[model samples]
Target: MDVTVVGAGPVGLVLAAELALSGAAVQVLERRADPDEAMKAQSINVPTAEALDRRGLLPAAEQVQRELLERVGSFAGAADDRPPGAGRPAPERRFTGHFAGMVLSPDLVDWSDPDLAAHAAVDGARMVPQPQLEALLADHIARLGVPVRRGVEVTALEDTGDGVRVDTTAGTVRTGWLVGCDGGHSTVRRLAGIDFPGTDPELTGYQAVVDIADPEKLAGGWTWSTRGAYRYGPQPGRVATLEFDGPPAGLPHARLRSRGGTPMAPVTLEEVQTSLRRISGADVTLTALRAAPTRWTDNTRQAAAYRSGRVLLAGDAAHVHPPFGGQGLNLGVGDAMNLGWKLGAVVAGWAPEGLLDTYDAERRPLGAWVLDWTRAQIGVLRGDAKSAALREVVADLLSTRDGTTYAVKKISGVTQRIDLPGDHPLVGRFVPDVWLRDGSRLVDHGHDGGFLLLDRTPDGAFARLAAAWAGRVSSVSDDHATPTGVLVRPDGVVAWASDTTDIAAITGLEAALHRWTGAQTSSPAHEPVS
Candidate 1:
């Protein structure tokens, strides 16, 4: 096979689909026999929504969002407004997520900011939990004819120069490339000897669905207390708490088994009850456990290198951080989006030299930034008086137009820039959904998952120039876009852009094309591996 993706979660599945879309023979191996029903991320960020939209999968995901809204109603209104069992009836305003434990108000955000304005094309967050998102992606890959094998664990990995040998519980797979999308305790990462280095944990967190004996006593939404922090219903029976005692099981992140599920062994009801009582200081009791509880920590870590020889890592295997801002899921999704097409290009034999290396160079910095972002929240969230004062100052700042805009920009990732070579401001940023003269938006043409050359010039010289890389890129004329012409990679990043088609600009476009698309080949330089 061209690529063997470990961990059949959202990241692996997305990478597999992109690989298959780029004409690579790919397969997925997951350790779980079935999808975990635990409530994971409640929403997806800007780039993730656009990634789904470009793949023609956003409608399906929006349907999932709609179904979710129909079930729970819109997540609107303030936490204190609802008494226990107060029936959260809302078509009210949306919440913009939280910093530390402080809830962000959508109204406070600066919608007029260019970053948020452009991101409005994709609009606000989509409320779909982790399991539903995974299901949606799994179905997409299924339609793409990618095989996903569950109950298969990666036991070992050997990168023998030419390819990778992956040993799994189910069997062995030999492929040109291997990606570890497995969770925090990734076997593939371990076997590959990739060093996962980062800060240690300072807090232990818990999320569970349970029957509370005194539900009315607990507060709604996220709450920071003198003890620690706790979040109660927007959903009945949903409970989460953080205690700054130490890491759950008092172990490092590497020693932990997975994202959740009571950590290594099953946590008892007594443990949760004790935690809730301590954190809330209200004597609230969890009467019955409805589902398996999961333990998390502020244990942040990232793989020292994304690629080591023929083996690569993505998603949780590549990095781990506190689940602040719901960034963990979106960060993993971004990794898949950024890495997928590049890896696929290499496997399809049209990628220029050092193209694969760019994955680590680009994503590792972003991963580090995310870790710090989460850590910043941790800094505001300790039970000490100083942290409380810090949280107040941060919250006050977040209430401002500029502060909220900056936060929104970081959270949405709409106008995020990579360090690509170019002087054009649009270069290294995600191309906006520009309209084409053909009456279709940019996303309409991206369904094929190839690079796009948007030439708005009257004579379409750039389009003609782009035709040389026909098999790898599609040239379209757009009358509405700002840039005279723009080259977008399969992942939607702008590789080249020009406002004036001067000789120098045109020459630069050609260089960008050659660097990204590899030699103007009429067809894939190599056939798909079986």
Candidate 2:
């Protein structure tokens, strides 16, 4: 096999699909016998939504989001009976999500900001639940003829220079590459001897749906206390709480979910009710517990490195942080999208020496950023006097136009830019969703999972230049397109761009194709685009 992907979660499935799209032989192995239907992520960031659109899964995601918005169930901050997106202003003017527990105001965001507006497209973010997204990807994988072997756990890995030997519960398999998309307690990462070190937990959090004898006794939405934070319903029987006292003395880690996994220990009526009373000081009583209660902590950590020879890590295996702002699922999805095509290039034998290493270089810093993002929220939610004061400051900042726009930009991931070598302003940034002259959009060509060149020159000079890297890139052109050329990577990042398709600009395009696609060319110099 070309690649053996561990863990059948969204990240693994996405990576597998992208590999298949890139013509790489890939298979997935998951430990769980069945899919986990627990309450996990409730939304996909803008880039994640665009990623789905790239794979033609956007329609299904939209359908699922409509269904999820119909009923606000266990998920906190879920939309009410109004509908998924009914009567909202322009997508840019809306409040992103929350910062800590404080909700951002829609009117406070500066919709006029060019940086934020540059990334918005016809499709904003979507509210598709994690389980729905997995089902969607599962169907996509079936169409692609990729096998996702569930109930098979990774026990060990042996790197034999050219390939990896993966020992699983069912049997052993050898592949040119092995990727761990497994959750936080990743066995592949553990067996690879990769260092996962970071800050410890400061509080224990709980989420569950139960029959409360007196539902009105507890406050609605997110309520905070000096002890910690708790959320008690926009929906009946839904309750979540966190305590600064940390997990119970010795309760086997009291974990119920790992970014995307099944429950570990059922939150009993006694355990949940006591936790509620301790934090809420309410005389609330629980009669029955519905679904398994989930416990998570701010136990943050990241892998020392993303790659160890032929063995690699992505998603939760690469990093773990508090599920604040629903960043975990989006972060993992971004990992799959970023690593999929790059790794495919490696397995296809056309990859440059340091191509695969770019995955580690580009994604690790984003993982670090997400960890601190969650840490910032925890700092505001610490529930101490210090926390209260900090909350006031952040809340004040969130009320301003620039502050709200910045938060929205960060949360939506619309303006995410990687540090790459290029002089063009758009280089290293996620390509803006520009409209093509043929009445199609740049995203229309993204579904093929190949490099894209959007060139607009009467003589089609740039398209001819990109033709040198045939099979690896496809070009789109028409007279109606603007007088600019853009080279987009498979992950939707702008690799190169030029304002004029002159002789000098053609030389630059040829060099970019060589640098990014590893295709040898005779182009000697690259002139920076003005």
Candidate 3:
């Protein structure tokens, strides 16, 4: 096998598919015979959409047939009072001070680059069912001809000198690398002996998805009645979800059981319907029920090393946490995307092994940042006096353009700026969507498999840099002149950049390249800027 991916969930399937698309022979081992039945993650953010789009999977994701509601309104206390639809005059807002945050529907946001902006607009989140998403990705992987070995478990893994030997229930297999896209409890992570250090939330959450006749009544986006403690969302068609803070005893009688169920009275569809009626004052009829236990763990842990020789961890295998900010699935997909290109390059022999180390360095901090912010948001949702006070400030800030921008950036993941600092604008920041001097959009580089150098000047040093890397790097010159040149990683991040075409002015280009490619290559000789 070119790559062995453990687990066939959305993350695993997506990773295998991405690697397959990049021409790597991949195999995915999953214990389940098919996809999971329950709907887990229901949202995708801008960065995630952009990542999927790069692999031409955005259209498939959209084809899952989910629609977004235009607005999200929050409530404080349960009220039986019913207001008219959006067309009618507004009723007195009962939870004026209790409202936490509003998530705008995705339709209102621009998604010109369907992949780039998949979750770009509509309050930094898009509502999509996890089952539907997984099914769609599974279909894509099948279409790509990647083998998904369902009902097979990876029993053991041994790192061979040159590659990895994977022992699955299906039999023994050999691969240049192995990726752990398995969920929070990943066998691959364990096999690699990676330590996952993080804190589990003291609180537990219960969610039930049911088929309701009047889901549309609850369909104006999700409403948080008890801050983060309790929430509800209406899915397209007749599906609706009710989630609440778990009791001290835990769900279906404590002891922290699996979604499969425990000894206590099983959570039934009638219970879900009854809970909905009690909370929302709507007598909803339930057709089906899916119950699960959830926790808000802020464990900001990543693998001590993303890769140990031939085995690598991606997605939940790398990090695990609560889904407070809808970052769980998105973060996993990001890990897949970040590792996909590098793995592709190495397999194709375009780059050396050292490039893989940057995956941990670059992504670990991002995981930590996400964990911190999500924890803060969860704290806000705890609904204590401090949280209430903070919500008021946040709500007020959300009303202004700047506040909206900040909130949107935070939620949508557009604000992720890498900590690579230098004088260049692209340094320590995400490469912005800029027009090249040649009138081509930076987003249209059309090379997703290798490093791209964007220089405005037709100079020798720039050419020399590309020449030194040869097939590993591709050079693109902007006909219109600018002083600086930018080098973008395969994942669309700026790795090395400069403000002047003198090439010599770009002091750290070589060092940056070596750091990015993980190759012990010599840096381009350049004079230090005084």
Candidate 4:
């Protein structure tokens, strides 16, 4: 096989699809026998939604079939139901989620910036649950003709110079590359001897849905108490509680010390009620526990390197943090999008020497940023007088136009800039969703998993480069106001663009093609340029 992706989660599936799109043979190994139905992650942020859209993997609005959270959810402030602008008739602005349990109101956010707004074609964040999202992604993978082998756990890996030997529960397989998307307790990462270093757990968190005996006592939504915080569902049978009382008490006996000396434990209904009572100080009782209660800690950790020889890591294998902003799934999806095409290039024997390394260089820092972001949130969620006061101050700031804009930009992943070397303002920034003269969106071409050259006036040189690159690079003739030409990578980041299609422009385009896709040494299989 060309590539073996461990863990058939969203990230693994996405990477497998992108690799297949780039003509790489892919096989996914997942330990789970069946798909998970729990609502692990409930939303796809704007940037992640765009990433799915670019790949044509985003399900239709009607197909999502879930509640549309037009406004972002936050724990920072109380929920607002006034439609952001108090029933005003203007650009609809919704809350942009929250930071530190405070809601960042949409009324305070400025969506007036044309450049930023250009990246906002989708309605808003979609509230698709984990199972539904997985089903949508599984459909996409099925269409790609890739097989995701379930119930196969990766046991060991041996890097044999040209390829990696992966030993799984079912059998052994050899591939040119192996990616560990198996999550935080990644076996591939462990076998590769990669160091996962970060902060230890400070608090234990619990999430579950249950039949509450006394639902009237506990109010819907968030409640901050001296012990901790708890949020009840809008209706009965949903509850989440958090307590700062160290690792959860009464862990099932099957845990204490697992492999690698890390602690492991199973959460029970009794413990859930205990935590809830301690945090909320309410005599809330559970009639029946519906789903398994998930117990996690604020134990943050990240792999020191994303790659180890022929083995690599993405998703939870790469980093783990508190699921404060629902950034975990989105971060993994982004990593897949970023690594897919680049790794595909290398496998096809045309990638630049350092192309694979860029995955770590570009994504590791973002991982660090998210870690710090969650850490900061935990600082405010300390459930102390000082933390409460600080959270109030943040909530006040988030009630302003400037504060809302800044928080929205950061939380939405729209302004998460990549550090690429270029002179154009668009370089290393989110590609604007510009409208082509043909009435098609710029993101439309990105589905093919190839570089895009939006050249207004294409000549023989541009045509020749496109021909030489063939399926690797695609060129489109369009008249756009921002620039005469734009070169976008497969992941939708603009690499090179020029104001005119002169000889210098052509030279720049050629250099950029080489820089991003590596040198096209094959003889030109010329395709006519429009």
lDDT of 3 by residue, 1-530 (tens): 77888877777887787677567888888877856665466667666655555455655554432232222222223332333222211222211111133543233223333223323322222444567677778888888898888778778889987999888778898888988887666778888898877655444444555555665455354444552333455332223333334443533222222221122344456655555565556565667654442322333455677888888988877876655555778788778877887787678665677778867877888888776766666565554577667866776666665555455556667667677756665575545555665675555563345667776655546646654565556677776455367777767677777767653554576667656654424454333334
The lowest-lDDT stretch of 10 consecutive residues in candidate 3 is 88-97
lDDT of 4: 0.75
Alpha-carbon TM-score of each model against the true structure: 0.91, 0.91, 0.75, 0.89
| RMSD, every candidate, angstroms | 5.3, 3.6, 7.6, 4.7
Q: How close is candidate 2 to the true structure, as a TM-score?
A: 0.91
lDDT tens digits, residues 385-423, model 2?
A: 988899889988888888888897888787778998778
- Quantify how close model 3 is to the true structure by its C-alpha RMSD in Å: 7.6
> Which segments of model 4 are wrong by more than 4 Å?
59-62, 65-95, 234-237, 249-266, 458-465, 502-504, 521-530
Q: Please estimate how well model 2 matches the true structure, expressed as its whole-model Cα lDDT.
A: 0.79
> After superposing candidate 2, which stretches have Cα over 4 Å from the reference?
73-95, 122-125, 211-213, 233-237, 251-263, 287-291, 480-483, 520-530
lDDT of 4 by residue, 485-519 (tens): 77888877788877766677777777787788776
Candidate 3: stretches off by over 4 Å: 21-23, 57-136, 139-144, 160-162, 206-209, 213-234, 237-271, 274-284, 289-305, 345-352, 383-386, 436-440, 458-464, 481-484, 505-511, 514-530
Predict model 3's lDDT versus the native.
0.60
| Candidate 1 per-residue lDDT over residues 359-436, each given as its tens digit | 999888889989999999998898888888998899899988688767767877776789999999889988876766
lDDT of 2 at 508: 74
